[model samples]
Target: MADPQPARRPGGRTARVRGAVHRAVTELLAEKAPDEVTIAAVAERSGVHQATLYRRWGTMTGLVEDVVAEVLNRGSPIPDTGSLRGDLSAFAVNAAAGLASPMGTVYLRAIALGVGPAEGAPDGGHPGFDARAQQLQEMLDRATARGEPVPTLPDLLEVVLAPMYFRALLLKQPPDEEQAHAVVDRLLALTRG
Candidate 1:
């Protein structure tokens, strides 16, 4: 029998290329609107061939989806600060900071505008939103495990995340720490009832 191929390591050349491409996309999104970020621009910025980009990502939407997923996963890691309040507060603050950033604003608007998959996501949802929902659920599960009174994911989303997103994406006002804390407090108050 022919020798089986070795499993591909994550830190290989492929990962380097992906990292470069993602960084290039991020920088471009930070500097300009999502509509202005083209595959050719990414190719030039990343020093990777346009053919390579087309072969790997298939489309600009695909590339944006990948970048959004990577950013959402890496940017705001779920906190484990022992108490629900601390965790929620930390998460809110981090989320506020991220949403306030130039790249964050672009990506969040992209996600909100459904710039990713057309359909067929797990639970018939956008992958970026699903990933964030999963992260929120993980935090809620941790709080439950600690015997803490936890609010529903919808409640958290409505009371905390929605306002931040609205402010950043619609109002053109990224939330500051004080606003984040106030939102957290509002969520906590609702959960206390």
Candidate 2:
């Protein structure tokens, strides 16, 4: 039979441990490459034991995955500016700014490497793509609730977002303010058409 689940502890030692671990992971990612951020290193930095990290996260990949998820959720919050265009433009600008940052580049590279070639990924795409897409869908859902005419998911991801990632990853050019707005305009036109 499976072992019993651990006892619950709300906002207690469990929370502190998780916070310390996450904070250590974030600081390490800012300073070092993803591969270099080992469990031992995190343990040393956070004062948490290596055994605890292994037991809680299973491995470095698991820890990094959770770290990236928290970063994405906290980093790319959906802005509500009382209009769809304003919201989309804000989102695009924020995304561009992140890609332009040194630590963001490192984090994204780590995410890409970790996700690539993972089993069951659609079309061998990034493993985190689904989660990212879900975040975008939630943003779109908010816009829809405000009576905005949003494009289909395929159109939003493939047509609209594809260019942004291409510029950041392939061209090595993260969009400036004008370029970000232009992307939003292009998407607006496509959705309108």
Candidate 3:
């Protein structure tokens, strides 16, 4: 008879280590600048070995990218309000609120500074951007499935996301709910034309 395969543990040691490391990174980012947070500091704070961090994330940028992705994903889930306008409006408001937070500001700065190339980018593109793009695409796909008119990704980026990001990251003024809704309305209007 063939040997039985070992059972996988979802919340195993590997998961614990990653959780500790991620928590450490987030705390450090809250207290200090991205450049000030280092592998040694994270190792000491997380109680995980420096070698383990290096083995898992490759570099500070890699670690930051993972943290940013996690933060965004957890903070702003895709809404399903049964309409494209409702979804985008909720998404925009949530996104704006996240960006307006202290941690969000830190994340925006890290992204703006171009931490490093993403894991699979051949030309050194930002992974955070890629993650957001995937999120937007998912939302668009849902809208399309519902027989709703959807703007192209570029149009969404330019009309909806760009303005919010510009106001938050560049202008240091995150949009309020009214402004966010206006941005969504503007994007929806584009689809009508």
Highest TM-score: which candidate? Answer: 1
Instruction: Return whichever of 1 and 3 wins on TM-score.
Output: 1
Q: Residue-wise lDDT of candidate 3 within 81-156, one digit each (tens)?
A: 8889988988888877777787877678656554334444567445546666787899899999999999998998
- Native-to-model Cα distance after best TM-score fit, residue 76 in candidate 1, in Å: 4.2
lDDT of 2 by residue, 1-193 (tens): 0111236464678767877988888788778876788899999999999998898877777677666655565566667787778877887888777767875675566566566454223564333455667777877887799898997767766665667778877788875777778878988999888
Give the distance in Å from residue 139's predicted Cα in candidate 3 to where it truly belongs: 3.4
Better of 2 and 3 by lDDT: 3
Error of 2 at 65 (Å): 0.4
In model 1, the Cα lDDT at residue 177 comes to: 97
Off by over 4 Å in 1: 1-7, 116-124, 128-131
Candidate 1 lDDT, 1-193, residue by residue in tens? 0001225477888878888988898888778776788999999999999999898877777677777766676765787999989989999999898888777776775575453346235455444567778889999999999898899999999999889988886788888899899999999998889
* C-alpha lDDT of residue 188 in model 1: 90
TM-score for candidate 2: 0.75
Residue pairs in steric clash, candidate 2? none
Instruction: Give the range of the ten consecutive residues with the poorest summed lDDT in model 2.
Output: 1-10
Order by TM-score, highest first: 1, 3, 2
lDDT of model 2 at residue 129? Answer: 50
